[model samples]
Target: MAKSDESTVLDSGPFYHGTKAALQIGDFLTAGFRSNYRPEIVMNHIYFTALVDGAGLAAALASGDGDEHVYIVEPTGPFENDPNVTDKKFPGNPTRSYRSQAPVKIVGEVTDWTRLTPEQRQQWRERLAALNADPNAQIIN
Candidate 1:
């Protein structure tokens, strides 16, 4: 068969969003929420990851007292490579991180993602604290 003229989907992602919020299937996760990394700032974009472990790490580090969650999500509109981790922190999007201004629907949930050990979690917490303490540090928004 001849190739069609229609455009192709950008990223074939089984994308995951990690957070402490308890969300149900069909729920919409949008921007304007306080950033998990910097709670003071309302983020302009909602971030997600293709790596399950990366999502897990995010969930683990997510603020608040609720249980960690890794949600399987589908982006409702266009998304772009998250510059926060792409070329700024790591080159070439090694984290497979992305962000969207549009909502991402909660299609399902994932439970088997690796959880951080208590010690590891603490270590990560300390690292975050140090980063937060740095006056030079900034989020890409």
Candidate 2:
């Protein structure tokens, strides 16, 4: 593992680790806000971080962290509808068409897996292995 002076070591085996992994996966996707809505308005670049408690996750990630590095994914469109139509109005508006936007999907890569402490790596590996062993494992909350 190539150690970088900038990196700091954190504890392993907490629920935060899984949360971090999931958020890291989400951040890998480059789909930023695409519209000019207040929520989608550009403020700065987005990154992901994790918290041990789900409430903490909701608070820290949804609210501005010290670094302004986290984002909370929320529903911005209808839950169900025809893909061909954008905005589904009453009887549908023919002139005012709203294009359907694709949901963001992220893929994660452990760029410095070897850099992790032995214990940290082991914990992560075990967590991942357990999930793989049982696809039904409720890893995400």
Candidate 3:
């Protein structure tokens, strides 16, 4: 059969929501995490709301207290924020979103308790232990 011009509906994924702690560990062991929709956009990186010095993390933590996992990730490529790419949330919502051209690398994770179970953590550790390991291989269930 010849290739069609239609697109296939794949599984809903690229889910960015997970226990912050688990995500941190995963980020540390793999490509750093990229900044999502932020209220501040000081750098060339596009932002949502006005600049709030040192308040972004605090606001995020205050709002997301349940999750304690923190991932220190770095961008793997340039930020792609163009007029057509900028995503606005809603009327009152001050959250703006952007997508990275390349995946990020995780540098380290900080969590009070391991989000993943022992077995799961072990599996992730093992899977991410290879020299050329796929960063997305570890999925925190």
**What is the C-alpha lDDT profile of model 1 across 28-65, one tens digit per residue?**
99999898878999999989989988999999999889
Q: List the residue pairs that clash in candidate 1.
A: none
lDDT, residue 18, candidate 1: 89
TM-score of each: 0.90, 0.22, 0.27
* lDDT top scorer: 1
Tens digits of per-residue lDDT, candidate 3, 8-111, equal 22112111222223343344222233332221222233121111211233224322346433343444444322222222212321322222434545554333
Give the Cα-based TM-score of candidate 3 against the true structure: 0.27
Per-prediction backbone clash count? 0, 1, 15
In candidate 3, what residue range of length 10 has the lowest lDDT sum?
1-10
User: Candidate 3, which segments miss by more than 4 Å at Cα?
Assistant: 1-21, 24-66, 81-98, 110-141
Error of 1 at 70 (Å): 0.7
Candidate 2, 76-141: lDDT as tens digits: 222222212213223432222111133323343322221344575467556656655674543110
TM value for model 2: 0.22
* Deviation of model 2 at 62, angstroms: 23
